[model samples]
Target: MTALRALLLTVAVTASLSACNRRDREPAADAPLPAAEAPAEITPADAAAPMNFATTSPYAAVKLTLPNALKAQTDLHARLYADEVRLLRQFVEGAQADRSEAGDDPSIPPYEKTITLTAAAETGKLVSLRRDMSEYSGGAHPNTTARGVLWDKALKQVIGSGQLFRRGADMSLLDQALCAAVNTARARRVPGAPPLTLAGGGEWTCPRAAATPFVLAPGTVDGKAGGLTFLIDPYKVGPYAEGSYAVTVPLTTFRTLLAGAYADEFAGQPAN
Candidate 1:
């Protein structure tokens, strides 16, 4: 998804009002980074297991696409994907109603909307699910945002940051590390871009202990534990133009902060 896709989820209803001053939708100058590196396909062993879902939707006009590994598994994840599809359809229907109520104008073009949810990473008992939405409904530009879910199969639950990290650990250090990685990534992606600081200034503000948002990144090598991947939404750290930022804090950096079975998985030998 592009930067514009970052705003789509929130703008579903207000697109009609914003469309009045809309400019021609331009392609994003930079592409949003992928949440993680995905395996080309589900392995033969995983594929041997049966998985099934209604791929096409008559109500939402949406399709449920899942990674082969995720599809092959018959578990809570399958139901999660189904629920995602249902929510997406609701968003689309809401957006369409807004458009209809706003009335038509020759100057305003038809809306083109897309919502996609994908599994960014699946290793052992953990899976990362990412949702990307992009919609253009008579606005100066489209809106987009990518959201993620960390699913723990053994626990049979969605893992939150608080549960993942040990209590009394230094969250400030985690915040600092995330900002540094974001600064480095920004400089590389935009040559000569001004650097960001911990303070609220420049491209974005750093997230604090209470508001650190993150997703899991795929390891540099397949099936390895890459560690926690931070998600910096537009306006959360920077202007909407910066889109969303994803910074991975390697497992090695804060192994001590991890807790429970997931922590054991993070500390274990890298998967080959």
Candidate 2:
């Protein structure tokens, strides 16, 4: 009987020990699971997402969007955001003042401003962007503008279009080509409209290449830039009614004028 009791006690102790071991090895029902590991690098879709902001009030309404590609560029993105903030503050103040003076004038519509920045092309260490802005402040019609930006990923800075050309290089050839292209585009938009003159009086005068904002256009060949697409805002080369114009100057037109550093970046033709 004593031996049997000892055996039973031994079995109970072993079962308890085993139960404890099992409890130690298993997770608690309420415990949180392990967190997922983040990706080592940003994916293309993540880089292409846009950062957007908007607000509306009785005095004004404002909207702004910045592409993730631009936002990924830390320094440039900071500068652009600072500039936008300043502009936004000014607009809000102006709108408030106008409202105060108007004293509930129903005819005065709420002032508005919308700005969007989008990636136009990316080649090598350069990313091209386009900015379109529209604003209205008690005007018959809203005013719209478009501009281009070239960001150097290596340098982490904005570069002017002139940098693509050799120092002291005569840009007259480029200007002539751009003018011809603009006139050709203008003719198609407004049938029988007088052709734009390179150096003529009035709003119909063709804007010089130096005066236009241009982005590196995507090319047919991968990893190579096709050409430059000039962004012309309203009232620059034509009446406001004609709206904006985008004219692409092929690489072949200005390939000879390219700086040694940028020559290799150009090839094929514009994708669109």
Candidate 3:
């Protein structure tokens, strides 16, 4: 009887030990699950691939190309994408409405909107980009527009034209310099056209350097900024027939106007 009791006690102890082992191996019902793996980071190589979107139907056609340089920065890329998508949606809606009202007019041309962003210069942490957008919805011709984007790599955001200069800096000097450059370019394009005056008169009035869109242009030396290139779309300083004008103002022309933070980023003469 004593041997039988000892045997029973041993069996109970063994079962208890096994139960404890099982409890240690299995997770508690209330315990949190393992975390999911994080998404891969975007590298320069991944950003090199441009983001392109295109679609066409009987109603309309849309095409957009965002350069890889713009994609390198996370926030900038998201902002640009959202803006482009919004514009694209508006165009699509307009096309749908036009088609509905026109009642299957086969002769009507399909509406179009093409937008492209190109890297103008990349020096240090500054990236200058030019955006050209063309849209046509049964007009005399497709209207084209140009804009400049100055992106700061370190900040991961866009730097406005006003931010590049000192607080309340007298831009009159820069304006005069840009006006002179525009006249030079105008002479080459339209030999007999009247020069643009800063006095703001008629169609030939010179655009203010502060109000115009401009990008940093490449310098003669590699990896350096030469100057600012003002992007003047058609009908700005001249008639639409003259097309667009890209007047470059060398660093020497507007060096003193630069903010203290941006003084070191510019050097050399314009490569063009």
Candidate 4:
């Protein structure tokens, strides 16, 4: 999702709620980083499992687009080609590194990925993409501070109704697809690949970071390679008067897909 999509969805979901914000629920005064907790590993066994929330059914009224708060993370998915392997490697390594860095410390929340796929009895294609936000965003907030309020508000909006379709692909298959996309990108891309349609598109939004921040440089590579690619003007004017970007990854891979670029501050996820 481009920053514009993130912003639109954030505005849409957050408009009724509130402008938000986090740390590991960062501890203050005399507090020490807690022990290292287990890593957040998304496994097939875990995804096949049942979920505690309600599933999507043909009876569903509206397609629940993720609220900005929760959708933010899901949106991290860069617009890589369908078969970029190195990109996928970075994604997995990122998961472990991010969680491990947080550690088992008392201040950090334990990391784990709980993927629930509920096929609506009516429209089997539309599946509810629910997770244990309790884990992903646990420590991301703290006692109802101003920041906490914003973060919590965002997650609440996205958790329930967000829909997903792995192209009829299950958890394992999706994982494989991710790896495949990353590999394909590596084989096709030369070192120092120039900014292409999907390069700078790896942008994100952080209302709290800056009024509007550019996450990366004018040239940044979206680490995936897919068969179908969408091209856009790298410097196209955006919602915040910034720019727009494109990607190769299928639209289904992400939710709340937007069409905008950024100021270059909200680049791809940080290096762990």
Candidate 5:
């Protein structure tokens, strides 16, 4: 099966925007010391101007079957995929099944349900349809906090705008092979694996030993803006494996951001 990529891979940071307002016609400062001006009358929703979602450039989507495996070979591999999914389901199902005898459950177990998208990826879109989404760990994100605010705004921009929202994942930690596609993906390695040699006269080096010694083939993507660093050795985690995942942008968000991003904040104003 094709590895599910570009699925629910989202990362975020704090951002904001500023709007200009017109000055109210008033008399001299001395004359203004009279009755305090009443607070600007608040506008009701029905009376407020409509917001244009089209200008926004974010598309909401959920990554299905991520942080989960599909198949396994050995018992060890089984633990990596199927077994893990089962145990996770057990936790989500909770003690309801334990109080009843087999085939007598008033409520059926959840593991058998077909919903597969993680809560993080499915956020801000059609939610009631994916009833089983409650079980996703990432889905139960807390609101009323700073991260929650950013998530909501960012997600709104993404879904409402229908723009391409690319999630960056650091796979250099998972599979060194991906380094072939994104040179920035370099991770530690195991012995007897490929070594990260300084290739093409680049100053890059393998952080750890490879399965075998090899050159650190540093390269660039054609007409792309980011650097690609390759990792050679395969690192192992006890009874499992791990790697880095990152999101990469492709001009769209960056261009959209130029209007309000870190560098664009000073735009539409005087040269100070």
Candidate 6:
């Protein structure tokens, strides 16, 4: 019954690379451009990729579960699947190497990495995957990290913050929004719960940087594409006892600053 902590993990931006591209255009002075439009049809399938079975290693140390749609016959999907395999393999090999080196150290117990799919859904044209990964090496505690994977099925490439956002956007405002969300969540905690303290029990606090940690939550026609959910690890924004916090902001709050398919798909959709 380990607590799931949302870590600021990194996922490679190789899937659906081409789909995030935008065509160049110049508008005339005093001329109004056409308003953005949502897709003609907005079916559940249109919003997300198909489901898939889970995969694991014979050693029972490494496991991988992904969308069935991600394992399609297309080259892009193949590459995506391969990438997943490679990442799991790395964890397996690293663990094995650690065990080999720990032969004389009775205090170090061998452990394996378990990657479980916790959430999978679609937002606009993007398919998002959230995984809870845990591995115990020779340390005081096991390493558990919450990770995110964002893919563009149309472009057959994975994406990251850069692909999801436009240039020259007001990043500081976005950071402030995240801080406010986290503080608000903290306020809702049960009475007497451990409070989230500053980094040093002083004025030091979470920074309003461009690379604020976050994960994309599921989005439906009813809910639409709200602002991306910001994820802060237990010790990152507060004490370890405070655990982790995830807070959501409305897309309308920063819609004008977004770009690419993420922006286009939610252009005309109402936020919740």
Instruction: Encode model 4's per-residue lDDT on 132-169: one tens digit a residue.
Output: 11113233332110100011122222111011122332
| Candidate whose TM-score is highest | 3
Winner on TM-score between 5 and 6 is 6
TM per candidate comes to 0.69, 0.77, 0.78, 0.18, 0.20, 0.64
Give candidate 6's error at residue 108 in angstroms: 4.6
Better of 3 and 5 by TM-score: 3
**Whose TM-score is higher: candidate 1's or candidate 2's?**
2
Mind giving the per-residue lDDT tens digits that candidate 3 earns over 27-115? Answer: 11110111223322444644443487677888778887888886666656655554455456556666767666667478877777787
Model 6 bad stretches (over 4 Å):
1-60, 68-77, 104-108, 190-204, 207-209, 219-223, 267-272
When sorted by lDDT, best at the front, the candidate numbers are 3, 2, 1, 6, 4, 5
* Pairwise TM-score winner, candidates 1 and 5: 1
Q: Residue 151's C-alpha lDDT in candidate 5?
A: 14
Q: Which ten residues in a row have the lowest lDDT in candidate 5?
A: 142-151
What's the CA error at residue 165 for candidate 3, in Å? 0.7
Candidate 5 Cα errors over 4 Å, as ranges:
1-95, 98-162, 165-239, 247-272
Q: Which candidate number maximizes lDDT?
A: 3
lDDT tens digits by residue: candidate 2, 1-272: 12212211121211111212322121111101112233123334434434766777787788878888866676556545544544555566667776666574776667776768788988887877787776666545666667766766786555665577888887888899898998899889998888777878655788788767788889999988899999887777777778889999999888998888778888999999
Candidate 5 C-alpha lDDT tens digits along 1-272: 00101111111111110001101111011000111222222234312322111111111111113222111112212212232243333333332232222343345322211223212111122111100121111112211100000111232211111111123422233233333323433322233333344232333333321221111111132212221122222121111132322212222223332212222111121111
Q: Which residue pairs collide, candidate 3? A: none
lDDT of 6 at 145: 51
lDDT for 56 (candidate 2): 79
Candidate 6 per-residue C-alpha lDDT over 1-272 given as tens digits, one digit per residue, 9 for 90 to 100: 00010111133212221111311111101101112223123234323433332434432256555545444424333433444455556555544554454452445334455555544456546766565555444334444555455656676455656667787777766766666676677767634434433343553365453454445654445334545766555555555555666677666667777775577555333233
Candidate 2 stretches greater than 4 Å from native: 1-50, 201-203
lDDT of 5: 0.21
